[model samples]
Target: MGELVDFFVRSRNFILFVLLEVLCFYFIINTSNYWGATYFNTSNRYAAQVLAWSNAANQYANLRQVNADLALENQRLNARLTQLLQSKPAAPAEYQADSAFADRFKFVVAKVVNNTTQFANNYITIDKGTDDGIRPGMGVISPTGVVGKVKICNRRFSVITSILHSEYLVSSQLVKAREIGTAKWDGVDPHLIKLNDISLTKPVSKGDSVVTSDRNSTFPPGILVGRVRTIGVQPNRVFHDLTLDLATNFSSLSFVYVVENRLQAEQDQLEKQVETEK
Candidate 1:
């Protein structure tokens, strides 16, 4: 205490000078309207800038949650669109729709609990399962496009075979030329998939749209798969090899729709009967 008193005594002149300077400034601002206005204006500008910087930092920290919410909202919009489009009737009776399939597709919105793209046979796990009406062989899609097929399901969780996996396959069709083929990933680029068995006669070009074919019992027809970004005609190969830019960006995927085809069992039984006759 004695040392503190001695130090204060030693620096008393400097402290007194600082106090007097502060009092002089306060008196000038208080007595003069122009000075007070200028001081307040400067303080307000600095405060606003500080507040803006603080808000920006807060927004940056909340970006992940915002993105997840946006994904979920997009998924809901897609579901509503699907319902509206599917509820409409066809234009004619003689349409003979080979691509138009009949499947009671139910969308179960679930967040991705697990995902892997670095392996040969990549898979994704969701926070839904058999207890939630999820089952094996159920088709899964996102708001952007097709994701994969459900391969396994437990009580509250399910594993999906991602399109990036080697074993993943979907019955796909070229929307522009109506060329149906099998869509599979080459396990190279995450965004690219191979559309094989499409005939060379079909006039396919860059940016040609691709969609799911009704020929498959898994996914319903017209579900967007991707767009054809490149087409290559190989030597000695009968069909054109096409590259598709996947509609769904798997890296940012959070929510997915587990499409349950209600008529799947009935269709399987009918196919079994046909095979028995054969």
Candidate 2:
């Protein structure tokens, strides 16, 4: 206590001088509006800088929570989009349907739980299962284009044979000419698919739009598939090989709609009978 008193006694003159200078400055600013305004402006600028830094620090700390909220909101928006995309036309009052696939091509919203784009036989898994009415051969599509057909379904999850798979094939037709053929991926680029059996004489050109043809056993007619980017007509070949720029951006796929056809079993049985006889 005696040492502290001695130190303060030696420094008291300097402390008093500092206090007096602060008092004079405060009084000058308070008495003059111009000086007061300048002081306020300087203080406000510093305060803004401090607040900005604080906010940035807080955002950095809460980044994970913010990302989660964004993901949830995106999921909800995707669900709404799927609902809108799958809305069907109302049946007539006199029309009565008993079959599940015929009556309910219900769109079950599913998130892409797993995806692969680097393999020849790539497949994707969805969060939906048989319990959700997802069945084998049911079509899956994103907003941009057709995805693929369902390959396997478990009690709680399902796998889709993505259009990028080499085995994937869909009965598709050229929109401009109504020429029907099977579309398959060649396991090359993720953005391209192949249209087979389009006869060389069909007059297909680049940039031609291709869509699903109901003539096939799987997809309904007119689902957007892709657009033609190149056509190869080899000499003496029966069909023109078409390279397509697929409509769907497979890499960015997050949400999809599973098409549940109510009459798929019946149709399969009938088609099987026709095939056996042939």
Candidate 3:
């Protein structure tokens, strides 16, 4: 307290000068119309800038929560879309009166904890597992397109065999031609994938859209795989050599949805029964 008082005494003259200067400016602004307008305008501009900076900071802080919310919303929309597509009738007579649209697929939103794309066989780890209803063989998809299939799962985490993996294969078809093919990574490019078994005679061309086939139990039908980038013919081969620009950018993958087909067990069991009889 004594030191503070001494310091104040020493700076009293300077403090007085500052106070007089502030009072003179305040009087000048208030008494002169032009000065008053200019002062207020300058103050308002500074205040607006401060408010904008504050708002931007707040938005940045809320980004994680906003992203989580969007992921959840996307899960709901994806589930709904799958259900609707499965319920669509092929023809008036083919539509069954007893066939009701059931939500067979459930979506679990998860954040990618780790991902790799440069290796021959890439994989992704997500912050969800058995506890979150994520299980092995479940299809994983990003907001933009198909991602991979779940390979392993623990109570709190799961790993996915990414589509970029050479061992990974997805049943896919051309949207325009309806020609079936097998989508596989060439173990060379992260942005490109190969689609095999599509015959050269099929009405396929560059820029044609490729998508998941309904025959695959792992992924729902029509989920985007990629766009046909190039088509080539190998001499004496029956099938066309094709490359696609994969829809999902694996390097930037942050969030994904694990798709659970509720009827998969029943379907597998029935198919097994047929196999046993045969």
Candidate 4:
């Protein structure tokens, strides 16, 4: 206690000088308009910076909700787009049905929980299921293009047969050449698929767009499937050997939309009855 008292006694002058300096500075800022203004401006800038950091944190926290909302909006737009694509462009405006009545397909936005592209029979798992109206044979699409077809569904989730699967096939058409064919995975390249049955006489070329064909019932017509990557001619083969760069990058899949055909059940029943009779 005695040593502490002695130390304070020795430093008391310096402490008093420091306190006086602070007091003088405070008084000068408060008494001078210019100094006060500068002080307030500096304080305000610090406060503004703090608020900005807080706001950025809040926005980062809300990102998941933002992604979900964007997904839903995309689903609605895609559903509307399908209607427009189904309409005949040559038909008169009078033939165009009202948007509400013209709706032939509904889309359910789903988050990808799992996906595989490294195997011959790759599959994708999504965070939606029968409860969300997803069912076997329903089509899935990403924002850029066709993704896969639903393979199985439970109450809360579903599995999809990825377009990369060995057995997966989609009826596709060349946009520029107007040739119809089947798009299938060769089980070799993750980025390339084969366009089979396109006749060699067709005008297919590199970079030509491939899209879902009208004959496919699983997915709506005209959805992008791929772009022609290469072409080859084989002796004794009537069809050209064609390769496509798949549109969907399955390795980076994050979200997708499941397509529901409003007329699917009706069409399936009619086709079944016709086969029964035949």
Candidate 2, residues 1-278, lDDT tens digits: the string is: 99999998999999899999999999999999999999999999999999999999999999867755665565455444434433432346666544343333455667888999899998999998988778888888776678998999999999999999887789898988789998898888998888899887778878999988756545655678999998887578898978899999988887777776566777889989999999
* Global lDDT scores for all candidate models: 0.84, 0.80, 0.91, 0.90
lDDT of 1 by residue, 59-95 (tens): 9999879877886676566656655555552447554
lDDT winner, 1 or 3: 3
Clashes found in each candidate (C-alpha, N, C closer than 3 A): 0, 6, 0, 0
State the RMSD for candidate 2.
Answer: 6.1
lDDT of 3 by residue, 98-197 (tens): 2333567788999999999889999999999999888899999999899999999999999999999888999998999999999999999899999999
Q: Which pairs of residues collide in model 2? A: 100-262, 101-261, 101-262, 101-263, 102-262, 102-263
Candidate 2 ranges beyond 4 A from true positions: 1-104, 273-278
lDDT of 3 at 129: 90
Stretches of candidate 3 exceeding 4 Å from the true structure: 1-6, 89-93, 97-102
lDDT (10s digit) by residue, model 4, range 1-278: 99999998999999899999999989999899999999999999999999999999999999989988988899989987888777653358778755543467789999999988889999999999998888999999999999989999999999999999898889999998888999999999999999999998888889999999878678888899999999997579899899999998888788899998888888899999999999
- Candidate 3 clash total? 0
- Indicate the TM-score of model 4: 0.81
Superposed Cα RMSD, model 4: 4.1
